[model samples]
Target: MHRLRCFALCATLLCPSPLLAATVFRCEDPGGHITFTLQGCSEAQDLQLHRAHNPTPGSGQPVPLAQTGKTTRTRSQAKPSAPLVVGEQGDGCGNRVTGSARRTAMIRQQVLAGMTRSDVESALGKPDKISTQNGRTRYHYRDREGSSRQISFDDAGCVKGKP
Candidate 1:
């Protein structure tokens, strides 16, 4: 009788009003990348063990993964492109002619006030070199003809002086 009473008490303590457990899904891509999703677990090939819990109904909150902080590593197997080449003659507008005339033209057309360092570098390849002094950063770009242009930026990274 004592054992029966203890079992009944334990059953009552363990069983609660009906509450459904959350669904979990694991997925693998063609590239061998594995992703776990809670909303789409039926597609998982290897079903893991299940536990009983009262997950809030329709909360739509994502279950945080234990390995969420893992970073992916990638390898590149292609060679880098050669430096851009320019032509010898000058355009009628006084701009030196170059095979990269379109790119140079676009860079010259951009208004410097709102430009960022990355934008300048994208328009013009990495500067021949960079120098900083007195809160100013200077980017120098040298052409094949030995002519060089210096673009200066203020602390805020906006062009501050004439290029």
Candidate 2:
């Protein structure tokens, strides 16, 4: 279903129309999952709109998009039921993670509670902001537009607070 929606949106948006101003939305769900949609991020505080400079011929009517349901997936393509426990710096053993696409997907699914500061930084890059309270520190990272998530570390450095 998600793939279908994305494909439909891409088809419609990719269809050039002089009178149409396409609205592409980048959304970060409450759980911090990221998605691009045909409509706006309903609850996003950091929405951005991009308009095509070139115009095509159309009466401003939105293009019709195909709505094919989800396609079958192979075993290898399946996501893990539980995210792998990565190393303190990303992979379980001490190492700097690489691979932009894979790293990003992994970061999105990482379990933060046990992650060290270096692991978080290596996965998500620098935090947008940092603060401390009662001897504990928090790191805030921004996602898709305005969505933000934070990880707090207790005195011993394990993430604090419920996920």
The prediction achieving the highest lDDT against the true structure is 2
Worst 10 residues of 1 by lDDT: 90-99
What tens digits encode model 1's per-residue C-alpha lDDT throughout 26-100?
Answer: 666555666666655345344443444565757777655475577665567444588556764543323323345
Every candidate's CA RMSD: 19.6, 27.4
Q: Report lDDT per candidate.
A: 0.64, 0.68
Question: Least accurate stretch of 10 residues (summed lDDT) in model 2?
Answer: 88-97
RMSD of 2: 27.4
User: What is the per-residue lDDT of model 2 for residues 1-163, given as tens digits with 9 covering 90 to 100?
Assistant: 9999999999999996655355677777667777677667776445666663334556465555586788999999999999888744444422323445445645685634555577667667888999999898888888989998888887866555484
Our tally of clashes for model 1 stands at 2
- The collision pairs in model 2 are 18-56, 46-146, 86-92, 87-91, 87-92
| Count of steric clashes across candidates, in order | 2, 5
